[model samples]
Target: MQRRDILKLGLGMAAVAWAGGAGRTWAAASGGSVAAGADTLDAAAWNAARQWTRTAFGRIAHVERGGGPAALFLHGFPLNGFQWRGALERLSAHRRCIAPDMLGLGYTEVAEGQGVTPADQVRMLADLLDRLGVENVDLVANDSGGAVAQLFAVAHPARVRSLLLTNCDAEIDCPPPALKPVIDLAREGRFVSEWLAPWQADHALARSPQGLGGMTFTHPHNPSDEAIDMYLRPLVDNAARTHAYAIGLDSNVLAGVEAALKQGRYPTRILWGTGDDIFSKASPDYLAGVFGDSRGVRRIDGAKLFWPEEFPDLVAEEARRLWGV
Candidate 1:
């Protein structure tokens, strides 16, 4: 048989299988239909962190599970708490895992006329921390969230117990070349309407390397459809939220953040995805220099932008050692 014939047969079988029994299992394992978001997570193995609280900012949404020292997870731009689902599940057994959908992302509702700048986010974080009844926390940060975490830790070192950093923006090259496309769109006021709207309309586009899924995880091709909707819709589909997030991204606001990391006092742990095309391999060391700590740098051999999603077990292991969980 020709190779094309064989490929056609395989596609036929896959479609047939998906139309029947195995598809159901895939859907269940992947958190149900594309709309379930984080709801369909298996409760037995997944701690299922869903809790909403009224904060001074608005009704903020967060994932909270387990009970011990507070371990707060911050997600990057264009994504939210959903990315930390696996880490939350793995570490919840020993520590309280709290992952929030920052200001305009996911289920975190941003109030009208609110700005989501890094400083604004830090203020929101403080308000949320106050409501969570915790004064200090072990913080884990990735991507744009890493910048936020750095600024927050530097400004309020008293609030952070330890910080675990993944691939993200450093002082030298903030967005990196590979990540500038989205930032560029935001600068022109065409992010939500042009970039995000089309991606949401086309599933394949959303999963392509040009979109969020491919930008996040590797090997698996793309994130489950549910994840995109949960993370993107809140910001990309809503004009207000999109505008809010874009405004924060449009400026050069990292001067204080750079100073903070260089001069701030905080315990730090470093995890970098060596295979990431966005943040270069030098990122981890650059971050270590910023934090003045080199003991905790560990590389995830082939993981990409969202390394935790690809290797949550490694993240959990490091968190266990770093936070003594």
Candidate 2:
């Protein structure tokens, strides 16, 4: 069949599957989503060392220090908790920062039967928080993590003290068109994982100077080899790829969060990287419409999608101002 026809059939099957409640089970059972490993922290010496915790849900890795209230960082797709390396270091000065590699990303152990869907990941996060003895937190989320953060905040509003979002798709109508094929292939458990593995590697490499001009949105110094390796570890591993794909396919959390927001209000803020090639800055307008009209909106322009890395100080300052840390 033509690729477009296959996609059409996939969409139909997905709709029926969702209606039949099969999608939920599929998410729950796609276990061992994140792989297990040692801390992937950069070699920078620190005032206090970062720590790792193995949770009932998966790996609960984070950097902690002198504390105010807790600030939890959630990384985006195809990236791990390490994505927040710069921000975590800065935030640790004022708040206890916990950054976890979502179920299928980073060095976290992939759970059995757990698909990478946002709902499943959010539940896993709740479980992880419980294990960590955290009651409530300020959440900073970027890219795909934004949707996960939204679901968490809506389902357990009291658990979220405040929210800070970067370039991420929060509405069903606004998801990047490029993601559809990836979602369909993931649902089918086909060679889609293999097909995308190289791309994942390419993206990681692109972060480097040599790779940056070729693949990234802007040119800067080449990213260290360690940085590239750390990013690619999860993608090259088959188990991690499976979980990542599953998560991508099951990302209905955006729709769910939007529906919930219509019922009530939450304190939210938006920061976007204008250079983001994946999800653009315009994506946050959905949140702006939902939360801005009443509570007011705050934006930090020119921060890339990986704002935590590109503009760590700005993220730290905005988060502190928002959280009153």
lDDT top scorer: 1
For model 2, give the 10-residue run with minimal summed lDDT: 11-20
Q: Which runs of model 2 end up more than 4 angstroms from their true locations?
A: 1-52, 172-174, 184-217, 220-222, 239-247, 262-266, 292-303
| lDDT of each residue in 1-325, candidate 2, tens digit only | 2444332221100000011122122223332111123222332322124456776665555545446677889877556666675666567667778888777666666656656677777888888788778898888997678878877877887788788887777675345554565556565664334443443466543443223222222234334444555555555676545546454644444665655665544567777666555564456676766752223445555434454555566777888888766
CA deviation > 4 Å runs, candidate 1 = 1-49, 256-265
Best TM-score among the predictions, by candidate number:
1
Candidate 1, residue 152: the lDDT equals: 81
Model 1, range 18-126, lDDT digits (tens) per residue? 1223223334554543223332333222223367888888888887767888889998867777677667767877888899988877787777777788778999999
Query: Model 1 compared with the native: what TM-score?
Result: 0.81
Candidate 1 global lDDT: 0.67
Candidate 2, RMSD to the unseen true structure:
11.7
